[model samples]
Target: MIIEPLGGSYDRKAFSCGVLALDQYLHELANQDVKRRVRNCFVAADRDVDLIAGYYTLAASSVPITSLPEDLTRRLPRYPVLPAILIGRLAVDTRYQGQRVGSILIVDALRRCAQAAPASFALIVDAKDDKAAAFYCKYGFRPFQDRRLSLFLSVATALKLFG
Candidate 1:
């Protein structure tokens, strides 16, 4: 199981995470996002086969300081917005669903966010559903005040976990 950038050699057409939107994104839109310099897509792929086990996208994002808990906001500068890295999308193929493929991809995404250039205060994800929210919560992600499905994990915490 190797994690790498999406490329021509990857079998994108055959990837199916059981979600139509996620499946369509890889086959039809991921390359566009990459080419436009908007988000970088990464895949957890088979070593011997080019099949993708899971995939995720990362991009620069921001969060309103007021949306954070008072305990957290009190420790930071009173900026209107804080820099963040967004995990735009994440999915594991049905064939790989129970094998921790999602786990592997998410951990990789968090590590990348933690080591990103120009610095970010946290990593954020807008979960697609309650199950997705629960999955992210397992990794210590806390919800934004405006939405339960929208969550974030501070880079400071990620550094501690990765280190």
Candidate 2:
């Protein structure tokens, strides 16, 4: 249950976890531009460093204020803005499926974002595909109309949703 920033010699093992546990479509997407976004990882281990439970990435990002619904924009202060991020990606490892590790990773992601990113308006992620979309949607994330693969959760909303 040890969760920390990704680094050290365990990267190869972690990336392999991503490649094998996540669908091919997601692995391919992660291999491209998305990798340049927020890339953070969480390692769950036993008494020894196993890097085995699961991991996910988080990065900063922005979406135009105009991309949000009119009501949301109006509710915000009158300045052009961008939503910020603590994106969740590469969320898998078959060895730990059904152990609720994914949920813990997400909770860690949100807590880190809320505590550290004051300029960030929301936590954003590009769900690898539809099934991922539903997973995010379950947590009060809303799909952006123009970007079908993307979803966002306002910091306030996310904190409340998870609490």
Candidate 3:
């Protein structure tokens, strides 16, 4: 599958894939969030908009060095830097369900995130609900100890798994 960054118009199919109102709102907010870094909005296909399959967005964000467990933080070079990329949203259209589209989107996101490693410690995302949380958990994203809305995976771990 090919994944290309989408912009310049609203993506109704992507909104439908989100599966709920809040998720749709979140997808829309990404387009409106001016403080975010370049939001890579992906639209998967085989070189045509007619083949629009699924989409996701990626943006730069930071996690506190102190939010990480010592095992991960202790190995990093001493600095206050805590680079991260937020997988703001990922959703596969219902027509494409059960065909590994979600997995493709995730691996694509990880691959993109990996390209910025060493400078980044982890990839972070807020799963919209328990189901979305479990999907990410399967890929090794663990919830922050006290934050139900947040989850993260170390860049090292992602590279080893997705590379």
Candidate 4:
């Protein structure tokens, strides 16, 4: 049940969340992304079984201010883009889906972004599908004006959640 940086001990090839792309990313690409400093991959790993229960990737990102709903942007500084953190991917092994593994991973991701060295105003995610989008909405993420599957939640709120 420990969520830590991905390492060689976990059986990457054994993870399958019913999505081919996500499964491939974890099996074939996550380590490269980490080594390239492009994204940080964290996994909920079980030491005894060498199994990965779930995983997520985080990276620095930005959002166009104009893409946000007017009600959300009207009070912000007029910068064209706002600094943010992207939860590039998140997936739970089918065996762990009903166990709140995804929720735990997202909370961990938000905590990291809230305490990041560089400031980030929000945390964003591009859902792979409508069902995934609904999971994020439970955490208060709002959709972008033009991207229904893309959503964001304020860092301030994340801070409040664990303050």
**Can you write out model 4's per-residue Cα lDDT over 18-48, one digit (the tens) per residue?**
9999999999999999999999999998777
Q: In model 4, what is the error at residue 13, expressed in angstroms? A: 0.5
Candidate 4 regions off by >4 Å? none
For model 2, how does the per-residue alpha-carbon lDDT over 14-89 read when each residue is reduced to its tens digit? 4344354454423344334444643544455432655556666677777788778776777788667675975756
Q: Estimate each model's TM-score.
A: 0.96, 0.77, 0.79, 0.95
Which residue pairs show backbone clashes in model 4?
none
**Cand. 2 Cα-lDDT:** 0.67
lDDT of predicted model 1: 0.90
lDDT (Cα, 0-100) at 92 in candidate 2: 56
Model 3 lDDT, residue 7, Cα: 53
lDDT of 3 by residue, 34-94 (tens): 3464666776764445555777888889987767777777788766768888888787777
lDDT of 4 at 59: 94
Candidate 4 has its poorest 10 consecutive residues by lDDT at 154-163
lDDT of each: 0.90, 0.67, 0.74, 0.92
Error of 2 at 142 (Å): 0.7
RMSD (Cα, Å) for all candidates, in order, is 1.0, 4.1, 3.3, 1.1
- Residue 79, candidate 2: how far off, in angstroms? 2.4
Q: Which is better, 2 or 3, measured by TM-score?
A: 3
